[model samples]
Structure formats: C-alpha cells, structure tokens
Target: MNVSLLLILLLVGAIVTYLAGDKLASKVALFFGLASLGCTIVLLNHYNLGENISFITRWITQPNVSFALKADGLSLAMVLLTTALTPIIIFSSFGNEYKNSKAFYALILFMSFAMTGTFLASDGLLYYIFWELALIPIYFIALIWGNGDAEDRKKAVVKFFIYTLAGSLFMLVAFVYLYLKAGSFLIEDLYKLNLSSSEQLWIFLAFFLAYAIKIPLIPFHTWQANVYQKAPTVGTMLLSGIMLKMGLYSVIRWQLPLAPLAAKEYLPVLIGIGIAGVIYGSIVALRQKDLKKLLAYSSLAHVGLISAGTYTLTLDGLRGSVLQMIAHGFVVVGLFFVAEIIFRRYETRTIAEMGGIRAQTPKFTSLFLLLVLASVALPTTFNFVGEFTVLYSLSQINVWFAVLGGTTIILGAYYMLKMFQYTMLGETNKRIFADVTANEGITLVLIVAVLFFFGLYPKPIIDLITPSLEEILTQINRIN
Candidate 1:
C-alpha cells in the first residue's frame, strides 16, 4: 500500500464527517483516525526490510512539483506518530460537548489531513502547501470554539496565525529560490542544489525564521503561551503534540541538510538560543498561575532542550531530538488533557483556585502524578531516556552548555512539583470530586503504558530512526 491512502482517508473522512451531520461526526472522525492508524501499522509491519512506502504523481506543470508522498524511515516514524496520536486526540475530546460537533470534528480530521500530508510530502513546494494548509483548520477551530473573552481570543489567534504565517512567508521565499536554482520542487532536487555560502546563509535564515517561530524558540516564542492558553484543549494538543515537531522535523529534513554550512556556522548561536529558551520558559512557568499557561511554558522549556540537541549536529543529538520529540508529544497531550479534565470540573484555569484534587479523585491524582513525573524526566519514563540522550548530546558539544541546558530537568521538577502540590495535594475542595471516567482513564492509561514500554526499551525506535539519521548525516558530510 502507498502512503497516499493514509492522507486520503483523513481528507475524505473530514468531508464524510461534515456530511454525516452532528449525530455521527465524532464517531466518524474517530473511526477514520483509527482506520488510518491501523492501515499505517499494517503497512509498516508488512513492508520488507529497506522497502520504502511511496507514491508519486504529476500534480503541477509550471513549478514542476509532483504529488509525491513518500514515507522513508524518518517520515514513517513521523506519520506513525501523527496517525497514532490523531485517534487519541479525538478520543480525548469525546467527553466534551462542542457547540457544533460535526464542524469541530471535521476540523480535527482536516488537521490530521494537513499534518499527515506535511510529513509525507516529498516535494518541497508541495510540503510548503501542506505546511500552510495545517494552519487554516486550527485557526478556525481556535477562533470559533475556544474559551476566553471573544476579543482576547481573536487577538491571540490572530497573532498566532499571523506570526506563524509570517515565518512561513520567508520559508516560501526560500523554497521559490531553491526551486529556481534546482529547477524542481522535489526534496532530492533541492538537496542536490549547490549554492554559494552567501546563498546558503540567506536560505538558512529564511528557513530559520519559519522553524524557529514554529518551535517558538526564545525571542520568537511570544505567540506560543498565549495561543496555547487561548486555544481549546484539542487545538492545544494539535499544536504541541505534532505541529511543533513539524519545525524540528524540518530542521533534519530541510534546514540542516539544505544549508549544511550555514547550520554548522551558526551552531553556537542556535544552541545558545535553545538554552535561553529553556531558562526563559522555566522561569516563566514557575510564575504562571494558569494551568494551561504553565503547561505552555513547560512545553517551551522541554522543546528548548530538544532544539539544542538537534543543532548539535552529532548523531546522538539528532537521534535524541527525534526520541524527545516523540516523548514530549505524548507527555504534553496527557498533561493538557489533564488540564481539560480539571477545567471540566472546576471551570477555572487558575492554579491557586485548585487544591486537594487527589483527596477526592484518587485515580486522577495518580495518573496526574505519573504524568508529572514523566514530564520531569523521572527514571524509567520515556521522557528520561529522551532527555538524558539529548543532554548527553549537549555535553559532548560543551560541558557547560549541557549544564545550562540541564537546568530544565531541575527547573521542570520544581515547577511541576510545585504545581502538583498546590493543585492536587492541598486541603480538599468542597466540590464533589468524582473519580476518573472510563474514557479518561483509558486515555491516561494508554499514554502511561507507552511512556513505560518505551522508557524501558527504546531500541525499536532507536533502530528504526538510526538508518535515516545516518543518511542525513551522510548528506551533510557529503556537503562538507
């Protein structure tokens, strides 16, 4: 089977669900999500060793871009993450009642469609189209269904849309230049282009504006927390869980390999910015009173380390970046879902307003605690494996750099534990705290199980991603 089916299912599912009316929208979306995931798993499992999952068709003439969807080892892992998480993201929202269920579910599926296409597109211009396509559904989702003041929500979402799209404008510029130079929008064609140092620098900076803003590194991060805090839980999950990874994935796939010399030249600056984000995000998180806002900053800090690992240009760093990307995706989704659960009960985001959650809902407390520990990169959690490797990669770059970047581990624990203590461990709330519902319990359990299973044995992921990473490195080395 080809990779195109996976995306076709999501796009078709969106339209089908939109037509199904409110009664069956969520179910249709969930079914389609699962079908895509199931199909992906089967395709991945049945493939002979070294065989690629790919399909290419003529889609354009002037730009010479083809409808090429190829899932190499790297893309497969990303697609797997996107598909697997889509069902979970949808299922996590089953308990909530949106105003228009059909429309909301359709946006989610459309998002899945754009995101899957983002991962699978082997054509650079096609990838850019998919990249921009992802922003639309999310923009509508956040604007229409989000919580908070209408004007404030508009401000936040507009800022988010404009900020990300502005960054992407520069990226589009870079792609147009690459197409002009390479004469094709194919990934390999762009990769084969040999530009002068000046050209690489401009292209790298253009690409950097897009990815760094998406990753929301340091100074470019002003849009992140506000957007996360304003968006619905589902929107936040889509943004954090996989959308952010699009930026990181682009670094490996587009930035570093395309502008190898520029990336190497800017290594110190990028690592510094990444570490600054860790420190900056952690400090802000400690001061956050809103649970969603806190989680948003926490994401900033965690991804900072992953960003640092990525820019290091070492094998350990690259692999660790992917591993951490996966780990953070799951953990952030669980954490934000917890925030939603609490909001459903309390109707508040202020942490000070929450206390003694555990005294009432012991099941939720336990699950929340496990997720917190996992976020802090506690031992035997997948987060630990990812964090440790990323930090080790940093250490290889510079011991002091690792020391600075490593502060997130300490700072994360401090804020997360502080958050837990204030929110979950204080005097019991007067309101009735019901135990975990079946759907919520199942979601949390599944999340924890993955964090556990992978924490112990990350060999499969490591092995799966190593060959692709090696090829990327070889590409970089050849450029060198």
Candidate 2:
C-alpha cells in the first residue's frame, strides 16, 4: 500500500533481471516492468479511496533528510507514465540483439527505478538523490550500447553527461542554500519559506539552469541532438519518451512551488524562450537528413510548447502541459521505434536513403502515418487535446504567445509530412523493407490506442491531475 513499493519493485526487478543472464534478461525485465505498472495501478486505486500511501522515514537526521515517497495524483500520474513506457521501450528492442543483453536490459530497469523514485520522492534531498541516480544508467546506456563510431559516441555521450551533471550541481547548491535557511529539506517545509524577492529569484534561476539543460531549452539544447543522434534507439527512446519529462515535471514540482514570485516575475521571458524553442526545433527538423536527429529536434519543439504552457501558471496551462507530457511521451517513443524499425531494415537512418516503404510494408506504413499525424497534433488523436489546451492557455496570457506557439502544429505538420513523404513514399527501395513483426505492431498499436482513446475522452486524466495542479497553484499564489 505504500508508495515505496513501486520503487522497490523496479529496483528488485533490475537486480533480478541482471542476475537472470542474457537468455532470460529481456523477459524478466519486461515482467518486472509490467509488475511495476500493476503496482502503480493498485496504488492509484488506493489513493482514490483516500488511504495513506505516501511513505516517509528519517534517513539523515543531521541535514533533516528523510527517505520519503509521496503519491499525490501528480506524482502518481508521472509514475504511471514511467512504468507504462518502460516495458514498451524494453519490448521494442526485441528485434535487435546486443552483445551483453543482460546488462543492457538491467540498465533499462534500473533507469526506470531511478526515474520512478525521482517522481515520487517528497523530501528535497531525497528527490535530488533520485534525480542524480537517474542519470547514471542512461549515461552507461548511451556510452556502451550506443551507435556510431567509438570516438564519436564517446564524445557525444561524454558531452551530454558533463553538460547535465554540471547543470545539476547548481541545483544541488540551491538545495543546500534552501536547507540552510529552512533547516529542512522536505517539500512542505521548503514551501513554507517566505524568502525575499531577490532570494527567490536566485533560487529560481539556479533550478532553471538545471532544468533548462535537462529540458534543453534553446542554447542549453546544444548537447541534445548529438546525444540523441548517437545513442542506441532504446537510449533515444528513454531520453525523449521519459527522461526529458523530468525537467518539465521538475519545473512544476520544484521550481515554481519553491519560488513562485520568481516564476511570476520571469513568466514572459520563460514563455518566450519556450516558444522560441518550438519555432527553432520545427525549422531545424525540416532540414535534417537523419531521421533520429529530425525526431530529436522535433522533441525539442514539442517540449518547448509544453514548457511554455507550464510557465503560464494557470490550471489550463498546467493541465495541458501534463496531458501533453503523457501524450508526447507515448507518441515520441512510438515515432522513435518507427525510426528504429526502418533502421533495422535499411541499416541506415538517412531519410533520403529510404523510400517507397509504403509499397513494401502496408501495415508499418499505416501505423507510421498515424504516428506522424499524431505528431502534428491532428484532431481525434491524443496530441490534439494537449496542444489545444496549451494554445488556449497561452492566448489567455497573451494572444501573441498563442500565435507564436501555434506555429508548432503548422510547422510540425510540414516537417513530419515531408519526412514521411521522403522516407515512406516514392519508388520502392531496392533493399527489402519488411513489414513490422508482431512485437513491433503491438507496440505501435498500444501507443496509438492510448493516444486516440485519450484524445476522444481526456476527462479522466483531466480529473486525475486537476486537484494536484490546483494545490500547486495554491502554493504558487500564496505569496503573490
């Protein structure tokens, strides 16, 4: 019944899967992933029934730290997203064989465990620990099993690692300063602080430095494309699907709540930056020949819109951001898998090298088209719901913001369709482009089903996340 059980399941799963050997590793990893999903569902039921699911115990009394895990609707929703996607990402890698399958699969589970903990931890110090822990597995995943030349992959992975780790230290310093003032590292305790405007601004900027690089907003995003282009498809999926959400999620969970005034003071600039990223990402994506690089830039754009929505500090904005986060997570993963599918067949990610795939693999072409449409935020797809709400929120803040941000859909459609036309249409490729296997089809189907179903009826998610967003808003407005 405790929230920690979710973390335990993922961690235990990682250990057991690692020990299970290469032959059984993938299966065991999938089993644990599904089990974690089940556990999250059960926790959701318990939370709905008004039971105490959050767990807290003192871990380091000196610094006032605790091993605490909170399962509010917001955290639970994120945990659900992590658990649900972990298995899908794991399962999608079935077609490719790695040299050390056990280690590869184990790192996936371990990363999931760290990410789940990051979502659930209620104590600031504990949250930071989980946040940093999530970085290690992904670093190894991209460095060891990643694609491209050894020196190139090493440079890309190392640059990403150093870039993110350096940004995180600023966050750690902020936490240390906050702990000094508040004498506690618990979220509620930190929220109670009534710091000066300048103090709050400094704290806010420090956190922003970390989140910006992680979310890779604008200039901070220099490391993103290289890393995404070089990482293995599974590594790419984890980064785009779930890891980047950590930065967006932290904006809500940590930055704004901790420094509401700073968020308010810098709202326009922050939103402008996000909108800029949207336009930038879309335009960059349009020119990329490599499919993974295109998708990576495409992610930068989608998340930029999501970030702008979150910075708006309205319920609709927050709700839209959360919805988009979930929608984007599923859809992006599906899209990357589509890229991987083509790579598996063609042995290349170059868009020009691919063509007439539609004539060869009707089923894959159909699913890939659906994912492309979803990326463009087409109506009756899950992405549409989030995109609409986000735009609406921006319009409320300033019509200009909405106008600028709306370009994502238009620009998104242009690039996505062009990529599709070049990669999937035209004369048949001389190489044999096989139809999707059952595993691949199942993954795309599951992703599409969730997107479309939620697109039609988004109320459940809206309802689930509203109260939590409202509380965060309350904390935000308490001083303002």
Candidate 3:
C-alpha cells in the first residue's frame, strides 16, 4: 500500500514505454496507465482494510525535507484523477501517429508521475520539486509536438513555460519563508508556525502569485488561451484536464491551510477576482470562432467558478471545488478531444466551416452532445452536481456573488449549444465524414461513462474527500 509505488510505477512506465520503441510506445503507455490506475484501486482497498498507505524517508537533510508520499482521502482523489485521466489521454492518442511516438507517450507518463507526486508530496520542498517537475514535460510536449507556425508555437510554449516558471519561483520563496519561520517543510510542521498578520500577508501574496498564474485567474490568466490554441490536442488535454487542477488543489491544500488568517481576511477580494474570471472568460468564449479556443475560454469560465468556490471557505465550497476539479478534468478533456476529432476530419478549427456532422456521424455526435450538455452543467450530468454545489456555496457567502457566478450556466449553455449546433448539427458538410473509430469510440465511451456514473452517484467521491476537507477546515478555523 506504499503510496510511493504509484510514483515508481509511473516513472518506470515512462522509461519502459520509451524503451519499447515507437511502434509499441502507445500500447505500452496505455498498459502502464491502466496498471497505475489498478494500483490506486488496490491502494484504496488496502486503505479500507486499515493498512498504512503513506510512507516517508528523509531525502534532503539540509532542507529538512523527506521523500514523502502521503495519501489521504483528498490526495487519493487527486492521484485517482491523474491515473484515471492518463489512460484516456493515451487512448486518445492511439488514433493519431505522433512522430517520436516513444517520447510522446513517455512524456505523458512522466507528467502522470509528476502530477501524482505533486498530489502526494507532504514535504514543502518535495512538493515544490514535484510542482516544478510537472512543467518540463508539458513544455516539451507543447514545444516539439505543437501545431501552427514553428516560430509561433515556440513563442507560445516559451510564454507558457516562462509564465508558469515565474509563478513557481514565488511559491518557492513562500516555502523558503515558511521553512525559516518553522524550520521544516513538512506540511504538519509548517502548519504549526505562528506567523504574524504581516508575515502571513506577504506569504499569502507570494503563494497566490504562484497558484493564481497556474490557475490563471483573471488578470493573471493571460498565458492560457494562446498556449491552449497553439499546443497539440494531447498537450491541450494535459493543460486543461489535469494540469490546471494542480493550482486549484494547491489553493486548498497549501494556501488556505498554511495562511488561514490571510485566506479569511481576503476571502471577499479573492472571490471577487474569481467571479471576474467567470464573467470575463464566459463573455470571451461567446465570441470564439475557433473550437479549441472556445473550449479554452470555456475552461477559463468553469475554473473561475471552481476558484470562486474554494474562496468561499465553507465545507460545501471545498467539496464542490474537488468535485468540480474532477468534473472539469473529465469534461474538458472530452471537449478538446472532440475538437481534435473535428479538426482531423475537416483540417480546420473554424466553427463556421463545420456543420451538420451528425447526419454523417451520429455516434460521434451523440458523444459530443453528451459532453457539451455536461459542460453546460445539465442535470443528470456530473458537472451539474459540481456547479450546483459551488453556486450554493457562493450563495451562502452572498446572494449577489452567486448571481454573478451563476451566469456561467446561461453563458455556458449559450456558447456550448452554439458550438454544438454549428459543429454537430445543421446542414451536412459536403466533405466525407466517418463515424468514430473503435479506439476513439472506446475513449469517448469511457469518458461519457464517468460523467454519467458520477452524475448519478457522486457520493463515493464526496465521501472520500470530505474528511480531508474537514481536517483542512479545522486548521483554518483554529487560525481564524
């Protein structure tokens, strides 16, 4: 039940997949992804049997850090997310022929490793290490394998890299400050430090700068749209699906717990900024002619709501944030993949160029429509559960805030329906169209299954994360 085994599996999977050669890399990667996910399920079963799944060993004595991996309910949720999404992501790739296929598959596994490590690392320095480790793979995945002009792709990847790197530096500084104050980077140790109001404020701001840019909220979100549009669909999936959750997860795991006073003090301001992103992103999405770009802005709006939910600092908010993180991860990946499906057929991203695809490909249309409905938070979809809970949390804070944040429902519906109608409905395009292939259909089916299953029975995931959120809220309550 050792949690670090999960990391080992993924890291080893990366190397093994690389060595497996180009022709077999995709299959090897998919196998490892499934194996890694199996590990999580087994770990959960052991957890239920009351076996210890957490273990730590001192790794860097100078920094007082440990090669630690701790999986609580919350950490497991995130790890499960990484593991669950990896196979789908890889499976999505099976339909394409990526050059240097070994490297491409290997990077995907490496990313899974880093993100899983990020979720499980309890030592601040160790967590920071994993945090920065994630950027490298995605950076390459985008840079080498990206689309559009070479120079333009280079610019976008560099901007994405530099912007996120700059954010990580601030987070490192904050961790350093905390290490000085507490003399250790252990999550438990840092939590015990009694910093003054001023100290908390600066540390809060520094960490905020890091997570804000990663989450890319409001004014700080400038790097997101371009990177998303420029990168290949796999790159875009990693970016939108799971990478963004690192920031939102950090806000709950690190920012709120470590600096409760600051979180409490600035709740209003933070929620305001998050809501602003919701409005701004949704409005921008309304006008996007590019399908990928539309999904990009739509991701911005959905995450803005999730961010706002976290700042509410209520149990409902935290729970909803977690729920929505999973929901968004699943839905956004599906949406982006749908975009890829469209582009592969038409070789164009322009929405106006696509119409009435359903007549030719009813199966693809059904899957795409299900995801679009989920994106708009339709009832009986998993996203509906997350969005409703988030809006409920906001209403608890203030009716007006909920009112503002709730616009995503109307706006999300508008834009998603617009995109759906233009792409999946209306007059059939004159070009030849084929139904989803077996591999692509399997991937989409897996995704749609998750949405419907969770949409019906979200209790399992909710229960899994609740105790952890409760523990976090206990910490914030003690400080406030």
Candidate 4:
C-alpha cells in the first residue's frame, strides 16, 4: 500500500472514534492507533524490499502545489515514531475520565493524523498546511480538558497558540517566495534553486523562526512550562512526545537543504543558541515545584541538544538528532505519565507534597525510578545511546560545545534524582499511594522495554536512518 493509506487510516479513525459515542471512543481510537502502527511496520518491510510507497497527485495548478506524501527512511522513521507512541498515549489515559470523552479521544486521533501528514508531505505548501493543522486539536484539547484555573489555562494556551502561529507565518512567507522564484512548491524544486546568499539567509531565518518557536528553544520557550502544566496529561504527552519533534525534523528536512549556504554560514551561531538553550532549560528545570512543569523544562533541555546536533550539519549530528528525537519521545511520555500516576493518587502536582511512595508502592517506585534513570540518560537506556552520539557530534564541532552541552547529563541527574528523593522517599506520606494499575503498568513496561532494547543494540535503527541522513548531509554541503 502507498503511504496515503497511513493518513487515510488515521483521518478515518478520527471520524469513526467520534461517531462511536463517548463510551466506546477510547477503545475505537486505540484500535485504529494499533492498526496504524501495524500498517507502518508492513510499509517499512516493503520499503526495505525496495518497493515504491510514496504517493503524489496534483492539487493546485497555478501555484504548483501537489498533494504529496514521500516515504524515505527519514520520514518513515518519524512516521513510525508518531504511530508507535499514539496508542501508548491513548492507553495511558484509560484510567482517567473526561467530560465529552468522545470529542477528547477524537481530537487525539485527529492530532495524530495531522502530525503524520506533516512528516510525510513532500510539497512545501502541503507540509505547511499539515504543520498548521496539528495546532488546532491541541489548542482545543488544552482549552477544554486542561486543568488549573480556567482563566489561567486559557491565557497559557492562547499565548502558545499565538507564538507558534506568528512564527509559522514567517515560514509560510518563505515558502511562497520560493514558489514565486521556482514556480513550484515541491521540496526538490525549492532545493534546486541557486539563490544568492542574501535570499538564502532570509529563507533560513524565516524557517528558523517557525521551528525554534515550535521546538520552543530558549527565549522562545517561555510558553512551554506553563502550557505543559495547564494542559491535561494526555495533551502534555502528545505535545512533548511527538509534536515538538516536527520542528527538529523540519530543520533537517526543509530548513537546511533549502538554504544550505545560509545554514553553513550561520552554523556557529545556531549551535551556540542551541547549547545556550540546553544550559538554560536544565537550570530552570531544577527549580520547578510543579511536577509537570519540571518535565516540561526537561523537554526543553533535551530538544535544545537535538537542535544543536542538527545544526552541526554532519551525518553524525543528523543521525544523533534523529535517534535522540525518538528516544526523548518515549522517555518524556513515560515521565509525564509517571506524573499523572502520582497526581491520581495524591491529587497534587507539587513535588513538596509528595513523599514516601516507595514505602507503599514498590512496583510504582521501581518503574518511576526507571523512567527517571532513562531521563537522566543512564547506561543501557536508549537515551544514553542518543545522548552519547549527540555529545560526540558536538565535540567534533568544538570540544567546548560538547563541554557545555554535557551539562544536561549532570544537571539532569541532579534535578531528577533530587526530585525522586523528595517525591518518592523521605517520611511516609499520610495519604495512600496505590501501586500502578494493570493498564498503567502495561504502558510503563512497554515504554521501558523499548528504551532498553534499543539502548543495548541500536544498530537496526542506526542502519535504518543513516542513508537518509547521508543524503541530507550531502544537500547541506552542496553549496560549500
């Protein structure tokens, strides 16, 4: 089957989940989510067999945009990430009840559909459309179902919406300008343009504005911690787990290749900003009182490193970024779900209020400790594999960059381990904290298994993504 089937499956799934009624919506969404994962595995098999799976059809004649979906190793790896994590995110919400559950579940599926399309779309205009489409579901999801003071949540979500939208407009302008010059909005056509240095600089900066906001790098990341705390746990999981990766992926797929010279010229500046974000996010995370907000800043630190590695424009940088993207997705989701589990038992997000959970729930404490370890990039975890490579890439650029970026590991362990001591150790809490339920256990176990399995033997993934990274690296160096 062609890649369009993947989008069709999720889009149709959204509609079906909504119509299935509130009582059945979660189950329906899960079914479709698993089906999408299975379909991706099948497609990956076909891709490995050297079969053509990308789909394209003309959609606009005047502006030369096409309804296109391209499935190469890079896009497919991301697509797989979206599909694989979606079901886990959905299932993790099983224990919690929501008002208008059907609409909530439907929106979750719809967001998945949009993100998948963003990863696969080949036409710049189409990719931009899919990219913007993703913002809609999360907006409503956070606004309606989110926690905290209604007014506060509204302000946070709206601010996030505006920041990302304004940044994205710059990117749309860049694409439109490229279309005018090349008479086409397909990625290949835009990449072929031999623009002057000035033109490439503007385009690169425009795209960087869009991506940096979405990735929520330093200064641009003001909206992140508040929104993550305000949104419901499910929404937070989707945002941290898969949505932000869209920005990092675009940096590799769209930004650099389209403006290779600009990317090269600004390499030091870009990497500097990224490393700054790493130091900044980690320091901020160490001071957070709210569990979700801490995780949010932690996310910022990790993505910052990923962005820095990508800006290095080396194959190792690209590959490490991609690997870290996937590893971070799984680990962040697990960590957020851990926060949710704690909130369910204690009915609070304050780390100060939580304590002595290890006395009551050994299973949960063990699992939570595992997630924390993974987040800190412990050896034999998938995060370690990715972080090591990213640091190596930075060292290749400049040893000092590696030295600064490595602060994430040191600061990460300190904050995370310290948070664990306060939240799970110390005097026994007066309130009861039950062990994880079967559903919760399943979700945590699945994520942990994937992290460890890949950590020890990352060759398969390394092999899968290497060739595509090589191509992007070639494009990056083409103008040099």
CA lDDT scores, all candidates in order: 0.91, 0.94, 0.92, 0.94
217-314 per-residue lDDT for model 3 (tens digits): 98988889989999899999998999999999999999988888898898999999999999999999999999889999999999999999999999
Which 10 consecutive positions of candidate 1 have the poorest summed lDDT? 43-52
Off by over 4 Å in 2: none
Give the runs in model 1 whose Cα sits over 4 Å from its true position.
Answer: none
Candidate 3's error at 367, in angstroms? 1.2
* TM-score, candidate number 3: 0.99
lDDT of 4 by residue, 356-459 (tens): 99999999899989999999999999999989999999999999999999999999999999999999999999998888899999999999999999999999
Q: Candidate 1's residue-wise lDDT over 1-480, tens digit each?
A: 777878888899999989998989989999999998998887677553556668999998986989998777777788888988899999999889988889999999999899889988889888999999999999999999888999999999999999999999999999899999988989888888888888999999999999999987989999999889889999999999999999999989889988989988989999999999999999999999999999999999999999999999999999999999999999999999999999988899899999988889888999999999999999999999989999999999899999999999999999999999999998998877778799999999999989988999999888878888999998887777
lDDT of 4: 0.94
TM-score of 4: 0.99
Error of 4 at 223 (Å): 0.8
**C-alpha RMSD in Å of predicted model 1 compared with the true structure:** 1.0
lDDT of 3 at 199: 87
Residue pairs with backbone overlap in model 3: none
